[model samples]
Target: MGRSRSRPVRLVASDIDGTLLGDDAAAARFRSTWEALAEGERPLLIYNSARSSEDILSLVDANLLPAPDYVIGGVGTMMTEGRMRTRMEAFIEELGPALDPAAIAAIIGSIEGAILQVAADQNPHKASWHLHDAEQERIHDIAARLRSAGLDVKLIYSSRRDIDILPRTGGKGSALAWICRELAVDLDEVVVAGDTGNDLEMFEMPLVRGVVVANALAELCRVVAQDRRHYLARASHADGVIEGLRHLGVVR
Candidate 1:
């Protein structure tokens, strides 16, 4: 007996950086492949990433890739849709007023392993950081302390160096889950792809299938390789995404 290929998925949600956008040729392939997907599988197309909607639109303007049906931006802090690329006001507002970024910075500032991100990189609901390699343990201790203090924020770290403080329940997985419910789409209909630590949540979601690109950080590969739901690609960047789609039977 052999490992079975994945069942065809009805929707594809993918990360942007090393997963989709790359060099000129890769971008062209991705655009053509995705357009074919729109005509063939006709699966829902979504960009699930750490970039803000504004950031993503810049890429669209540059002709790097076509606009996705849904933009899961800011590591899922916001979602936007339609030709106008408007933010889903009701969904973002649901998280309530964001805590002051300075408030969380005050806490991380004292932590030995964490360094706060720049102001431009900060989001109302997300506090970004860069962590020292040897401080993984201290990072946990600090996060626990923050939670115990009832700061009620979730810490998302990936690629070993990046960390984000988010509302306890707001994240890529949670946002994607919300999209499914709002569209009345079944969990089994969705498949996800990514290339770094931040994307772990998308693959970890019990309801979705995971596809990892070849260029993913080694740490990410080690963590996701054991999962039965994940498909590790043979190529890098957009080529890798195309490989996963084929493995999933999304395209011939």
Candidate 2:
């Protein structure tokens, strides 16, 4: 959906869980490939995940993942950058008012099977939950209930288990777009990777190429299949990401 693929990649953003994790060896390979690139050729790296900024940083500290230039965390409601992990104030300000988790909890209190995620997963702008085995109708009903109650939010159901309620304007795609605008990077020059439904938003961005790891959830695969700009790697996790990057000519 973006311009053309002729532009050299200037940014490589990926989800942390199923897209870039799971295989230590593959993670090492990705790190080596990324580090091997000449400094001027290296793209701005970003890790976009449903995880908290601190949670993602811990992985970097442990060497499980390469450090990122920026982190789009909490399902895109929060962002932080650099070693000190400074909060992205402009992004936060653009997200408008934060949604109250308590208010959202009360609204969905009576919805059967809608269990709130742990406090660690909850954030000021994201009211997350675990709705495993719940019917799509039921999940939509919960979202409907909240909207009917006057809350302006978006419902992202991913991994067939997670339900993240974020501000209508928030999502990985929107968050990445904000970064591209701020950094003056063209959307066509940004490549994204992920493996779940929540990661769908990033893939949906117009003109942005994407990699859907082989281990990705079916919900994500079905959508990516329709877009030829996105590559579905045969390998899983980090290896899949590397495979897609090579296929897209973003890496050797």
Candidate 3:
């Protein structure tokens, strides 16, 4: 369903890469739009990204992006709030057990085309890799091997090259939903924005409005097209996010 104009936006959670960081002009426009909102009318801003919380914070510190009220980092395996970097313990607790990186390594090591990403890209709950010219069947086989070994994990492939293995309960959508529940914000009051395959989960969430940036990947765009709750922006990057917010009536 389309976002209702009657409901005031309470939160805006967005992916970082192509969604917010691509164009300097668009990023500036988005910042201006956000800063222009009146205090009481402003919604809680959330930066949901595949980067680690420290990485996200660095950008905020450098003023490349506006400071966020909350950050869902490490592709949802990690969550932190504000500049003080307070951990969301409840969200961590719900993630159950840390993923076994060693076991994951053993399983994926046999796959010739897979290359593990840098240490900075991995966390206790996430194992990231790069797939080089691999087929979809290879990706599926890798996932199957992990599951057969009794690991409760979810594999996310994005930009046709990156692979992230997260706990079954962790993802952008789940992290955002958990945050909304903790903050007592209705799903309808939230607008999630993204531009790639990894961001698809957040857009699939029922009752939450979605912003599919003009530069979004085809896989994501295909899904967004079928959903009435999502807005397909005319502009790219952060400019597209601003356009979508206007269309959803979150911004004037």
TM-score list, all predictions: 0.91, 0.95, 0.95
lDDT by residue for model 1 over 19-89, one digit each (tens)? 89765687789888877654655788888888887888778778798767889887878889836788898
lDDT (tens digit, per residue) of candidate 3 on 73-169: 9999999987679988889998889989999999887788889999999998899999865667878988899999998899988888888999999
Q: How would you encode candidate 2's per-residue C-alpha lDDT over 77-121 as one tens digit per residue? A: 889994679998999999999897777889765667778889999
lDDT measured at residue 234 in model 3 versus the true structure, 0 to 100 = 89
Runs with alpha carbons beyond 4 Å of true place in candidate 2: 1-5
lDDT-sorted candidate list, best first: 3, 2, 1
lDDT of 2 at 98: 80
For model 1, the run of ten residues with the poorest summed lDDT: 1-10
Q: What's the candidate order when arranged by decreasing TM-score? A: 3, 2, 1
Candidate 2 residue pairs in backbone clash: 1-207, 2-207
Higher-scoring candidate on TM-score, 2 or 3: 3
Worst 10 residues of 3 by lDDT: 1-10
Clashes of each: 0, 2, 0
